[model samples]
Target chain A: MSQQETVLFDAQGPKARRRTMIGTVIGALFLLALAVVVVLRLAGQNQFSMELWGPLLNPGNENFELVWGVIGEGIVNTIKAALVAMTLSVVIGTLIAVARLSLGRYARIPLIGFVEVFRGLPVVVLVYLSVRALPDVGIDLRGWPGGQVFWGLIIGLTAYNMVIFAEVVRAGVASLPRGQREAALATGLTNGQAMRLILLPQAFRVMLPAIISQLVVVLKDTSLVVFVANFDELLSQGESIIRNLGNPIQTFTVIALLYIAINYTLGRLAQWVQARQARGSTAKATGGDDLVPVRDGA
Target chain B: MSPVIENLDLYVDGFLTSLSIIVVAMIGSLLLGTLIAAFRVSPVPPLRAFGTFWVSTFRNTPLSVVLFFCAFGLPELGINRTFYFFGVLGLILYTSAFVCEAIRSGINSVSAGQAEAARSIGLNFSQSLRFVVLPQALRTVVPPLGSVIIAMFKNSAVVGAFGVGGDLWSTGQTLTSARGYETLPIFIGVAIGFLLITLPAGAVLQVIERKVAIAR
Candidate 1:
């Protein structure tokens, strides 16, 4: 059978088209069903009253002051925690990844094990453990007024982000050809010199997307700290508002939208970086495969 | 200090609950993920789009939002308090989205020639997918899927936010608040328990990956 004949004869033709049409129809119906259920439930509870949204949306409403105040504070705390954690995690992750990729087996084994365990543990558990233990060792983390919850949050976020960044960096480094390192060594570069000058820079470019992605993960994971430190990140702030309003639907919906905004912005930033790199590569005369030197050793 | 016998039992009970949730959710996510993966790779454009939307939405949205929406938001809409059930349901839905993408990527990694060969031998699309594509894809996917499962188990801690009647973190919270025993030991215990579950699975996944590489 010819290529054209196969294309025509295979069910990838009309059947696929028909299935697509059906799938769209079903999707529309599903969304409609969901909307109807939501509307009906709201109607039964009279939650659809314009009164609630009015105050919430109104710039001048008194509750708006508290709501936005809490949100603003939460935003500040979230950013602080995420920034601290991101810095710590990246630094620690680099060290750990280096340790894992080290020539010594004994060193590699423990580092690898630590990464696995930390990555596998939940953020809440880490936060809880940190908060519970730090004070007992005379650290008195929580006793310093506002500093207690901040430290706990930082520790928890760092623990998980460390693992993620380690994996990302390791994979990035491994993707580099061994010859790059070998070339560096041929120039009389030391092991550390080769890694820093030849490998780490290139690895970072490759791992840029993964690192950006882990940032979002770390951001959301910050919410789990409410379990331990009880600090008011966006989620906790929303929860507190809901506790006062006795309306989980509206408050949580607001919170969800806020998260979507933050996460979506970061996602777009990552895509932009990726696209720039893609265009840069394509624009250059080196073509695809000939670009980016790969070293098989270093 | 010697471990307290009574506290040990409580910890064991918490571990059991956590383990059961993890097991059930893992199975559910795998099945859900597979079906979604199939849909995603279908020749049908709409199916592919729908699958993409599902995965992207779940992946981007916070797991806490999903848990809270199901547990609290649904109940407001006449879904009664089936906390335990809904808790697992939410986790499965969230985790499966990630799993589906991983599986889809694995499927795409398989050479197109293999599928063509399977079809040339008179196998249908489903048969080719099952015998030729899936087996290969699954072998490549085990390591990532193991990571996803482990992540899901860790994420179930979010279910504690639902004020669920029982679970490890919730029980720990209850005990800590009531007994005022140092929350440190219990927290450490839970972390260790979580590590115990995921580390072995991760090791097994690596072993399998190595075996597959050797076989190849």
Candidate 2:
């Protein structure tokens, strides 16, 4: 209950110590009361009833197979959408970044406009526009099984994320020491060749953590397909489950947990990669005299 | 283009709706986020744990799912409310987590020496943080905080599709699907509505980023 006193306070006197103890008890009690009220509220609504939660959480329940199979399909569809979106965004984004990095000023201007427009608009608008609007302009974006729904979701994700990815990779390349580019160019390589061989490979590696974190965003965004195109991803599937089971809270809670489970793992991987990079960039310990080469002795 | 021009009044109504959602959610999230951020940094252990729980839960969960609960699940709990109320609630609940993180990082960015100096002058921890550290931290936080708010502006579009109608997404959807209007121009008009808000906000943030950027 007391502050850390973190180089920002003197040693506590007796009165201060007593006050800390009192505050601790009061804080604990307050939280307990809040928890109790929440539980009581849920219970009052029959939210604690086993019929609502058992099929989702308990494998022994008779409907367990039915409920989970539906959710499993949702999970598969969600992964399919997010995976396609991520791959397309990275590949197209890298290409756009390369084009901008190598092209003339006039050529880059239109590409800049493309990035700005896509980045500025909302993804739902993008999906809706791609499906409903673009057919008039000779673009029928229907190839998948669910056609407009799936493609709308993917195209929207790609349009939004590819621009962001382009920016990320460009930033990654810009972060490289100028000497790396100068060194590549001084060796007589063409600008395109230099970018492909020297700059992009390194930029992808340097930006791996940022890219993974972005994938988490993509994964979460897949659920938006429910609202935009009704693609039967995790969210829409959850809605159907709610319709049948009459347990909106419990069903959606399970769906949310599934999302958090996957995205949290990806989020951790991003942190791990970032930490590894931080460690890699720091100077390592030098070897002792005996371990050093005689010619370049310590 | 003509369709967009013909439906200018509908566009304006949608634009106003979007603006109100943004304004309400923006203020609601900032207030809630600040309180949660305080909980996070406070010395009380339970409060800190509660704060951490709020941040991680919302951070990992999809906004759609949160809105699902607000829109559908809340009725199960008998907390009936208007869709706009629930939509704004979902936005605040989700966005405040990001806001809290931004604030915590801002607090961390305040150099420790400032607090130490404040204490050396006979101030307590609370006084030092409020008077000496927070002002500096708030300045450093403006840019990232701006980005979070921009992201929220983008996310509120999701609300309209979730039955919070009369906003731009619904406006665009209704014109194309029900009215059989040309999809390209009507949706483009809707896009312009959003761009009108976010693009200028981005420029203003850039200006603020320059104005308050500290050397240290």
Model 1 chain A is weakest, by summed lDDT over 10 consecutive residues, at: A289-298
Cα lDDT tens digits, model 1, B80-188, are 8678888888888888888897787577657667777888899986787778777887786666666677678778777764555466777677766787766676566
Clashing pairs in 2: none
Error of 1 at A71 (Å): 2.3
Using all chains and alpha carbons, the TM-scores for the candidates as numbered come to: 0.86, 0.91
Write down the lDDT of every candidate, Cα atoms only. 0.72, 0.80
TM-scores, chain B, all models: 0.88, 0.96
lDDT digits (tens) for residues A147-259 of candidate 2: 77788788878988898888877877776777778999999988878888998887777778777777878888888777655677888888888898888888988998899
Task: Please give the DockQ score of every candidate, comma-separated.
Answer: 0.43, 0.46
What DockQ number belongs to candidate 1?
Answer: 0.43
Write the residue-wise lDDT of candidate 1 on A1-298 in tens digits: 1321232125456767787688778866876787798899878987766556644577877688888788788777777778788889999988888778764977578777777788777777787777667777677775654588778778777877787777777777777777889999999999899988888888787666566766777777777766565787887888888888776777777777777778778867876776676576643222222211111000
Q: What is the TM-score of chain A in candidate 1?
A: 0.83
Q: What TM-scores does chain A show, candidate by candidate in order?
A: 0.83, 0.86
